[model samples]
Target chain A: MPIETTDIARLAQILENSGVDTIEIEEPGLTLKLVVDTRPRIAASASPAAATAPAADHFVTAKADVAGHFRAAHPWQDKPFVAPGQRIEAGAMLGLVKIGLLYAPVVAPTAGIVDAVIAENGAMVGYGTPIVRILPHAPSNPLN
Target chain B: MIEILSVTGPASIQDLGRFDQYRFGVGTSGAMDDVALRAGNILLGNDENAAAVEIPMMPFRVRFDRNIAFALTGAAVAAEIAGRAIPPWWRSYARAGDILNIKAMSHGARSYLAVSGGIDVPMVLGSRSTQFRGEFGGLHGRPLRVGDILPCAASTAAIGELGIEPAGITLARPNAAADETIVRVIVAGEYDAFDATAQDLFWSSSWTITPQSNRYGYRLQGPAVKPKEPVEKRSHGIVPGVIQMPPNGQPIIQMRDAQTSGGYPKIATVIGADLWRVGQARLGGKLRFEQTAYSDALAAEDEMSAYLDRLRANMRLVEETRTCR
Candidate 1:
């Protein structure tokens, strides 16, 4: 099982004592194979409960996938397409960009409500920049 | 089954590599010499993709905690157990508590040690690879050190003796005669920024790999490559081998440690399979770039993968046939 939380210490303990030195777990067709150090002594010098903190609440700063002019909203409208706390899905269009003579829509990477907008409308975006932050809500039907 | 007695130099757990996680701001850093990594696995009757210890210039010392079979590959590193030299490539069964030692590597830059069932290390982020940038993965996200006891899982599969061919391996190094290195790039989004002379220089001149080269990126010391047009752009996703040139014109080839996205202008991309060859290049190794069509790049990648597949299949067949005899 994927460690329910990101706790490194607890995960280490479970792996050491489990006797199953290597655990091959799969979720959503993605397999995660972890080799559990059966000789727990290797990590004996390591302290448990080290990485139990939550991920920092960093702002979403979506950049352009390619160099293009940022469109804050849909082509037909003038106001911004989304405000803070607006829910969005994966592949949902966050905005548009003008590349050459073509207008391309930037899609959301994850499912979450809109969190922040770093680029203003008509601004140019480059590679390796954040375009939108989707604050994922609790799964309504996780199994789905 | 094999106990580590002593370990010097940079040794770490490595697998095929970390992948499909670059979008999460992670770099796909793994074994520097993958050919050696696979050979080590074949010698141990383990999966070719199993994790192993990647050591560079080793004086490696290990004591067998139990009776186990292990193999070493890559470089011309000499091995000795209890002061008696052991041959490379072939698997040898060591008794419990036997001391195994390795001297300096003569030719290549790295060596791999594969124990049956592979080295036991907790996985992080879907890989046994040690990605040091995030300070996570591998054995506590750091290089293995002395007194670090490694465990191996028990294997139920048949133990097959390997016939290792040490002299058959070939290692790639920098071209000594070339005065300049030209790294080819297929112009991506912003190819129009430079005037004719600048574009001419980008393809013709050789770039030196600066001493600052690391898993994150290799900064090239050569002519500056600027775009034909000037305009500020927001950050987008980035990939390995993307030659990103900032305002200074010096291009930096992003390696495994590159961020997921960036605002720099990218002129070209290195093919995926050849990225490891780039990783093997030591600091100060000269690099030459020549443009190949994207289709050609894909064909090269397909051919390489197919060759690897055949190599693995042949290794497996040889092991099975040997055990039967």
Candidate 2:
């Protein structure tokens, strides 16, 4: 039997009320799949991977949020995420800290030009250990 | 929901597999790399048996219609969502309207995509795995095509985005060479029928995964493994991992989609614990076999279970870190 437009609306309502994300129904000559929530993209929380470390004026330090072996690049790839003197946009990935088999990303919290990548590649690092120093971009800066 | 934009080769939904139904002539159709599927689900905070997309052909592209977290495992490939790089063996959130594109992998065969809450397909015969030949389970029991939208169940679990080390790399094999993939096997019932030369050649020669290979079976190209005499046998029940010697004399390893019964004589069976390594083995690559004892196979199984246990424990810690934040 074919489902009417009214039946689909009712199904969607029921799925939403049940707090479910999806439902699939099948019958003779008909198949239906309803997804209740499809909008409202989940944005990655503002650079949650790294902690902010204290630094001298005009510069900011990116720190490891988890204790692990800091890797400058993914194991399968050759290029690093960021390098010294590179212009880094806000929310860019700085590197990764591998904890056991899992690797947690290290994201930049603020936009700036990278001054130095302090964390040695493949070296053990503790939580909040300084990893990258960036000269913060400012309205008055000529390089902006 | 995620809609397929472009795809190559055969891509389908798979779970652990539908078992205990072989009497009905149904073969278990599941992820070629079962370990990758299991790990993908574990990484997504879903049940280990949750259904996932098995993409063997690369250059697959899809667009996410909902914001959901997904994990990729198996082959090492360069994948991206909305131009943002996604690492292999990693789980991350995909925003609505984001497109994920995976190019052909440099290594391994199949790649799995397990989303948060798992793929929500109508299950057939106690599984969501696709039976291509029978065409009953999964999405219409065939390969995914362009414009196919896959629905996912609700993501209720609190989990953090992360990547686990590939199990093939973490699990160690004794005296295995880096350039070769060595799979442990046990002598099948018809093994003794083969003469000493053929039996010795089985272990000594390098077997190439031929082009005729598919989900049903892998036709290996190596030394002729003919038995001393023609041992014609009646059709007998068979299972995946059984290595059968056909008339051509090359070994054919039955895979997940193989028929329930076959007429060929069996030489050896790849151990249950080591099948995943063979599953990830690249086509045209060289493979070697080692005959192992039963107890050692059990030990290998235990080691794999231990690695998965560590993954679960560490993933839970990722959630804890979020709560602490």
DockQ of each: 0.01, 0.49
Instruction: For every candidate, give the share of true A-B contacts it also has.
Output: 0.00, 0.79
Clashing pairs in 2: none
TM-score of each: 0.59, 0.85
lDDT of 1 by residue, A31-99 (tens): 666676555475654755445324335334444554457777633234565677787666555776655
> For model 1, how does the per-residue alpha-carbon lDDT over B1-325 read when each residue is reduced to its tens digit?
5555677766778887788687677777777656667767755657777888877646888887777777776655677655644444545556677788888765445677778888877777778887777777777888787777776777334343333433222222244342333343566676676777887887887778798876678888887777666647799888778888888888888876577788988777877656655665555767777777888777756755664565566566655656797
> Which residue segments of model 2 deviate by more than 4 Å?
A1-56, A142-144, B155-159, B174-179
Best by TM-score: 2
- Sliding window of 10 residues with minimal summed lDDT for model 1 chain B: B165-174
Error of 1 at B167 (Å): 12
Q: Which residue window of length 10 is worst by lDDT in model 2 chain B? A: B154-163
- Residue-level error in angstroms, candidate 2, position B79: 0.8
Q: Is the docking of candidate 2 incorrect, acceptable, medium or high quality?
A: acceptable
